[model samples]
Target chain A: MNQAGYSEETMTNVRAEKVREVARLATRTGRARSGEFLAEGPQSVREAMALHLHNAGHGGQPVVRALYATEECLDRYPEFEEMAAKASGVRTRLVSAEVLSAMADTVTPQGIVATCLIPETSLEAVAGLNPRLVAVLCRVQDPGNAGTILRAAAAAGADAVVFTSGSVDIYNPKAVRSTVGSIFHLPVITNADFGHTITTLKAQGCTVLAADGYGAADLDVLQDDSAARRNENQDKAMLEEPRLESPTVWLFGNEGQGLEEAEMARADHRVAVPLYGKVESLNVGTAATVCLYASARAQRRNCT
Target chain B: MNQAGYSEETMTNVRAEKVREVARLATRTGRARSGEFLAEGPQSVREAMALHLHNAGHGGQPVVRALYATEECLDRYPEFEEMAAKASGVRTRLVSAEVLSAMADTVTPQGIVATCLIPETSLEAVAGLNPRLVAVLCRVQDPGNAGTILRAAAAAGADAVVFTSGSVDIYNPKAVRSTVGSIFHLPVITNADFGHTITTLKAQGCTVLAADGYGAADLDVLQDDSAARRNENQDKAMLEEPRLESPTVWLFGNEGQGLEEAEMARADHRVAVPLYGKVESLNVGTAATVCLYASARAQRRNCT
Candidate 1:
């Protein structure tokens, strides 16, 4: 093989104990016991490597514990090769297609997978940073929804994302895949007490906004009012009011039952994304994205 | 039985011909042959029923062809009773849990499923309505992404949603499920020629905007400029410019590969949803929702 650092050796045994252990990371109990998660597909593996490189000098531990890739995947995707070269600390192992399949949770693993230490962030650390925008997912069970929300938060420039204890495990392969590499972009705090997280954010001068379908404050009206205020003045104090544009933490709830009354009450305001048509409401993922972007746009305007 | 009009029948055999026929609608070929689709779970069934009732007098066909529910499901959900009462035209049948399971595509079928006629809308019909906002899904393959886009468009007050022929089947069960009952909210046109759709939309005085990651136009800047223009004047002509606030159709492409070059050329503007953080870009669903809502907000302000 002409490729440098590409292992010529191949693991052909699909039933090997090592391959089974890697596949077990797909389950919550397996992940808890191993303290590692699988980052499958080229996008996820690439991003994980990039984050490892970026955090190298910040006292962050090596995230990419090992990489398993097929020879064809390495040849077809040059980016994977580049990522492997960048993360020299990660152990690379060439595997057969069957071996890769045995280690992947998905029907098709895209020829690349990585074993990574589960990333952790503390709520107090997130709150201490005084983040201008944060996303809180409370009891959100769908891994896809949870991952997409994290992705949305990152794109919307949220400083952090905190998932309550009742939420899905962030390291779940399905959730990690849905993030589409955004999981490596910012701080994601998991398994935090919902009430304490909200209180901490509030103490950090953040206005906690609960997203609910039956909430009193309409999102459109809130945006309109904020736009009006922005048009009136560019003063820093005026722009920093505890409204949609201010330092905000958006609380999103579960797929089936949304935020309970107690959860909604923990927030400073309950905001509803208005439905102009007959559609009853937005899904948690779409609603969270809109709310995050609204704050992103407002905060950017305030800065200008 | 105390329940009025409730059938005291149960279908215990999962391999019954009726069960097999209902399960077939989960596939494209099955839906094509039967001219019907499955609306699974309570949310989808309820919305399908409401839309059926709403369109009853408008020369629309009977939408609900048949209803399959387990006895336990009917006993637990009173809304099912209400829907049954409202939809007297629908053939209601009681089935065993196993029979219902055999007929559902989801892992958990939520106890109720309805076979509904495929709702059809012509592009000409959509164009003739002079819709202020429409969402065009061009070759978007992900069923969940396609359905979420439909849901977002309806929530954003779009008059219609058009899916190009290359896109996933609108009747795909996952897409229908992801719509969360929003599928029946408005006119959804599928299998339309992409170029013809754009030209027709343009001829209707609608501005065609293609969402691209590499586009020159920034969404936030566009929103800010439109907001400024709206603050300056409320004149009808001023509001009708080819801007974010004007009559607009947002073109979103596939999950992996966005809009092609030729497709981008068809739009009046190619807008990029700004990424404030290190995240490479937004998913098609989140990006489309933000774009649709931006236009929704701008147009609503213009009207005021």
Candidate 2:
């Protein structure tokens, strides 16, 4: 190896304990400590570096502490060098494929992994958009389900996603990997007080609607013009004389408990996907996608 | 322990090996021999059992096998007991949690899993659907992606899904898990010749549309009747005759390579999803959902 090539002599400590520890960080608890999670593959690393540069300009701390790039990543993507060069505040360490294997989360690492800090956004900042549609996750435990919901929310044009109590860390490595970079685009807020959040949205003249497995609000009925007009009138009466349009928040509940009775009661409307199979309910992710898109489709049609 | 509790005793050769082997079957080779892949959760198990019953009757293997319901599963829902009793040739056995754990695929199994022989579906049988819309997967390897695509196809009303060379096993436990039981409702065919399949669809006057990142056909063209008509004359001239508007087989390729040039060239139309991110492509599942739904939406509007 060339002396100047990646400065192997100056490489940071790859202590046995540290390797064992980071491997353990594969779990959710370890990831929360550093306020950082792992992102693998060339595409993910590139996006993290770009986001790091963007956020670093703000008072936000540098998110990516390490960039593990393999020979193939360097050779195949010359842009990796460009990104690494621009990430001035972030540490960029070059590791061999063998070392890379230890740090990488996926079975196939795609020759790169970057440690990225979870980005935090405030509810007020999100509300500033006066977003017509939003998604709320309650006690969603599965990272894949949570990540898929986030991806669906973004694709369906939901203004933001808020995680209520007991949901998995939005920054879990599996969740991040599952999002396939959708995490970079959406406004995600976690650990919210569900009741207060609903109240606050109501104060802002937002209609808080929770998706219930069993509920009276027929989504199909919501599509009807007569029913929508009735909803609009009801919204106007609930708030004030001025009648500021009420934004809608679509709440999804935990996998097992689903929506709490209290939460369901708080919702202006409770709705479900009409299902036709021996299987009673769709998977949480699928349900969220179908619901979010249904809302989006409805809103788009109504607006036009 | 009761003698009748477990059909096979704990001391038998099958006990320890069964648990260890189920754990080891994470690899592909092991799954092939078991002839039975795991399906997790009450929902997955329910779907698998129904499919098993349906296929058993269809294939003339109508000998209903023993029904092994774990104690926990029975405790959770007593309703299963009544249903289990009514089914002919079904002998119910109660398995301990330990034995159930050995058979589970998840770290925290939903406390329910069922074993069923893979349902066999021939390509000719599915093609007989006169499938107005079919999803064709060529060399897609990820179990999650394959499963999600199948789920999406079912949701979007695709008549069937055909998997070609290099595709993951649709019957793999993880793949089945990912499908969310959509596998039971839809027709899925695996291990078909890619070239022959394409030609077969083409001969039937079915448009073989391939999804490509650099597709010439604008996706919006399908949404508007005028645009579709405008392109129809040009397309007809190239084909030497006007198409009578038959069914369509939409091809999705490997996650990494996408559709090959030769495959795309054979396509009656090539369509691409417009993306707005540094990441080049959507996850295969998301991409397939957007495309399939786009076509379905178009079809719905045209029908009305």
Candidate 3:
């Protein structure tokens, strides 16, 4: 057994017991206890290792905790040998297919898995944010929805994301998988008090926009203004744009029951994308993207 | 055995055999041979039934083939009971939890399952479509990716979708579930020839825009000309905005390899979304949504 108490031989073995335990990590309780979640496929594992290195204050080196592989994995990825060799600090374990399958969270293990801790970010780091744009998710239960929203927010240049009570865990393995590693690139806060978050943003002089299906404000009107601002000096123009000057918070609600009446009432503006289709509404993740991009377009138009 | 070698009594008696059969339906060959694919959850089942009704020209009433349910399902959904009461032609088979589990495609069966035939649409129905927008996916292997793209295409007012050769089977249970009934709303053609599709679209003068992450044509730039046109019309004495026109085909490619160089080279235009974040690229689904909406937004801007 190595210092971690997992026998080098046992850790490298594929057993039913290990597979069951690894699959159980899909549940919240199992992940919390183990301080680990499953990340599969080469892209996801690479992102995990990259995030570790990024957080370790290194530019391009790998800062992985543990790297596991099978003979098939090595055969499929000859390049990985050189890459792993460079990360000397990272512990390596060679396991069989049985072990790989047992430790895999996905139906197909792709012959590799890695263990890494979720990096903790302090509230103080995000509190001083002069965010021109932000994403706010309230009671969104599905981890996929929350993760996709975080990804969209980051892509749209939102400075931070705040998840009010009742939302899924940001670190949920499914959520992490959905974000495609954007989780490590942005400030994501969870289990925050809705009232407090709103108050803090309002105090910061930010505009709070609630995205409702029947929102009164038209999305086109915002997009038109933002496009105009982008043509001028961005730094000076940012302050002039109504959407940008007012640090904005976009609130997306639970999958089943959208934003609460009180929560919608608290926002300075309510906006919606026009729907002409048979379906009643867009999924929360899709809606967040449209809304965030609309705000981004609006901010750009007005700033210039 | 009474009709079709599957009598009510025989089905009731052979619970294990039925489950084995249902589980086998996960594969394309099984689904095709049985003339049915699995659909569960009250929402999806409802959608499936509605799809059946529309196909039968019953003016919005479903023409179900069979319904396997427990008392729990009937009790929880009185609407299901009421619908069952009205539909005498459809078969309803009361089942036990064990029976339903065998029939379920999901990890946790919603205590109900249904078997329905895949709907068919012809090329003539979509040819020369004016207000129609369609998503053409080529070789997208991931069921989730296919599903997400379908859902986004529907939201952006697509009239239909077509899956080219090498794409994941649209009837895959996970793909159907991910679509969230968009499958029912849109006409989908699968296993199509690319050369033939491109020829038909060209005959209709349907602009084909392929999405590539490295394309020189900025997606925002494509919108710029249209946005300029809108401003021109408003000025009266100014100019007319250039419109890409609606009913265009947006081609998205495989998840990992993305659009093939040859395929993209033949496109009318290649567009790429700007990325400022650490994440290398957006998920296939998210990327499709952005491109689809950009096109929709451009057309709407010009029309108005």
Judged by lDDT, which candidate is best? 1
Residue A91 Cα positional deviation in candidate 1, in Å, after optimal superposition: 1.0
lDDT of 3 by residue, A15-57 (tens): 4555566666677787788766666667677777666655555
Which digits, one per residue and each the tens of the lDDT, describe model 3 over residues B45-129?
Answer: 7776666655556554343567777767767876666655555556777777777776777877687777766765555567846
Ranking by lDDT: 1, 3, 2
Candidate 1 clash pair list: none
Write the residue-wise lDDT of candidate 1 on B36-67 in tens digits: 99999988998888777777757686788888
Top-DockQ structure, candidate number: 1
| lDDT, candidate 1, A83-175, per-residue tens | 777677877888999999999998889999999988766888887787999999999999989999999999999999998998999889999
TM-score of chain A of each: 0.94, 0.83, 0.81
Sorted into a CAPRI-style docking class, model 3 comes out as acceptable
TM-score of chain B, candidates 1 onward in order: 0.95, 0.80, 0.87
Give candidate 1 regions above 4 Å deviation.
A1-8, A82-86, A236-241, B1-8, B82-88, B236-241
Listed for each candidate, the true contacts retained, as a fraction, are 0.81, 0.04, 0.30
Worst 10 residues of 2 chain A by lDDT: A237-246
2 or 3, greater by TM-score: 3
Give the whole-model CA lDDT for all candidates, comma-separated: 0.87, 0.66, 0.72
